[model samples]
Target: MADSASRAVFLLQLTDCHLMPEPGQLFRDIDADSQLRLVVDDVLASGLPVDHLLLTGDLVHHGNAEAYRRLLDILAPLPGKRHWIPGNHDEIGAMRAASAMPCGREEVDLGHWRLLLLDSTSYPDGRGSGSLSETELVWLEQRLAQSTERPVLIALHHNPVATDSDWQDEIMLGNAADFTDLVAAAPQVKAVICGHLHQSQARSIGQARFWCSPSTSVQFKPAQADFLLESGGPDASPGYRWYRLYPDGRVESGMRRLAQVAPDPELG
Candidate 1:
């Protein structure tokens, strides 16, 4: 590893691992467990020096115990310091069985970045919302005030802005405008990262950059008018986003897709 002061902070962003016990179903007939394993294998084989692996959420499907167990089995061998925030399909209690990941709040200092992982899965209808409770907002405000020099990266399970698709727009962060106001008020906020959209996108609002990473399982076609699952194709391969954060306040980000070999060639 290079000197922490000079080396760019490298983070791997993974999301939406909707694992199911039975295989060959929806979402391209892609087995979530196998796809996640393939991503980890490729990341390890590439030998990229990653500072942390950040999973934004939907770590499991149906929030079942067995699914969480399978998620653990796949992630146990993957290298690097890991952190996670849950999504709509995840259950806080079930995910706790595998790791000590934050359920609603987390803060970490990585080089020049102060990362705040928020739990934005606060909706009743199995969709996502971004309502930071009064307590959480106060805590975040205090943290922002204290660390004015370091760039802040906020991670959540929902996109803070609409992707302009009707189906997704309806299910996205409900209190996005309020969240945006808070982010705009805090100049230390350099970027906002999230999952749930299952696609790669980068947008700018105020002075901050917002990025949504591709999923480790399936991906939704961006800007499609209706809700639809993607088919098995070159674009649906499991992948992640790599972020390079510079001390001088510049960010260079890119996507990396795993080369997945069908578990059973005959089935395909």
Candidate 2:
């Protein structure tokens, strides 16, 4: 039998694929199909003990049906469990068609921990806004209530609280306070994982930790002033973030940036 207490759950985080499988490019000089393919290749070749693959969001460039289809094809070869959450650029209809075991909510039991996937997307507006709705909040409260013994990890596409980066702060979740309040009361809530900033960042809110994953496509340079969008400069290597959640309720993570052979002409 599988030793429930001894085993650990490893979640591989990949975000912002921005896949534009067609001939044309998308997202500020990024070739979605090529860059995403490279990241996928790296993930598969890493041979890491990944219990599940989590695509946080922005999997497609335009949230179109065709883009989602292409993404499904690219990710088809990946073994192990997979979970997805929609972002500002995600199409609900397209996601439904692409995922075999599609679900808006995933409550995965990872031995001593529980992973909760939440959808914080307000469609049509590119700026982020998180709404749990009364129904969803109630469900979440109940879920957390079920057991205080298991460490709970919350995953969402938008940053639940302000990150101080002015550019990203504009697109942050509007209902972040409400969400934080909920997590504060729940002792089991360990950390909050998110992707949308297109850059890796970390901040603490209340008793929880909030982390943003770097993109598999183009990256947004860390800002100091107001909102700024980074364009071509030099670094073209693709990157991803790996997070380890310890049984003692501690967390450790790092970024892995790959070296591409040469800059693609399409990007210039």
Candidate 3:
């Protein structure tokens, strides 16, 4: 790697693995175990010196302890410190038990940037929607207040902005207005990252951008009035997001989809 690339903090965001209890189990005809393996293989082959691994959410679909254990084993080879948060599908207790990094440790110091991971599984409405508690909201405000000297990147499992899909939007962050209003006031918050949408999309609030990454398991089709999976197309390939945070508070990010994992035509 070039010195410039090496100097910046490189972070990989993998979301919505949705792994089942067993290796062969499939969600929407996409094998989570094998798809995540492909993602890991892709990262290893790329040879980026990932400074940190930010797993946004949906680490496991079944909320089983064994699946979380399996997730750790699959990702053990990838370099750097790992941090995660709870998704609607995740069992927080199970996830914390399977990993050493406490899910409650929200702030990550990345030299010039602050990475904040928030638990968005509270106050669920049973349709996969989640809301932040009054405590967590206050906590986010406190963190944003203190990070004036460093740029901040906040990660949560729910989308804080609309994906334009009615059904999907219905299940997005329930208090997104509250969330985005918080971001709109914090100029130091460079971006807000999230992943329940299972597709790549960006919306802006104040100086920060809200980015939703593609899922390692399966991707839902974007811009639809109704819910639909992206099946058997270029966009359906398993995907992830990468970011390079520079010391100057400049953040450069892009995404790559693993084309090797072809989408199943019957899934839609």
Best by TM-score: 3
Clashing residue pairs, backbone N/CA/C < 3 A, model 1: none
Quote the positional error of residue 189 for candidate 3 in Å: 0.4
Which of candidates 1 and 3 reaches a greater lDDT? Answer: 3
Name the 10 consecutive residues with the lowest summed lDDT in model 1. Answer: 259-268
TM-score of 1: 0.88
Residues 141-219 of candidate 3 have per-residue lDDT tens digits of 9988995988998899999888789999999998988888888888888888898999988667667866778999888
Reference-based lDDT, residue 220, model 1 = 87
**Would you list the rank order by TM-score, best first?**
3, 1, 2
Identify the runs in model 2 with alpha carbons over 4 angstroms from their true place: 1-5, 21-24, 123-130, 224-227, 231-236, 260-268
Please report how far candidate 3 places residue 182 from its true position, in Å: 1.4
Compose the digit string of candidate 2's lDDT tens values, residues 1-268. Answer: 5464665567778888888646467667767777777777887787766777888888886666777777877877776688888877777678887666554567887767888987777433445544555665677788889879888988888887776678677777767777788899997887888888777676666677667777888877776466554565434456777667777776666666665322112111
Query: RMSD (Cα, Å) of candidate 3?
Result: 4.7
Candidate with maximal lDDT: 3
Query: Which stretches of model 3 miss by more than 4 angstroms?
Result: 1-6, 260-268
Q: What is the descending lDDT order?
A: 3, 1, 2
CA RMSD, predictions in order = 6.0, 5.9, 4.7
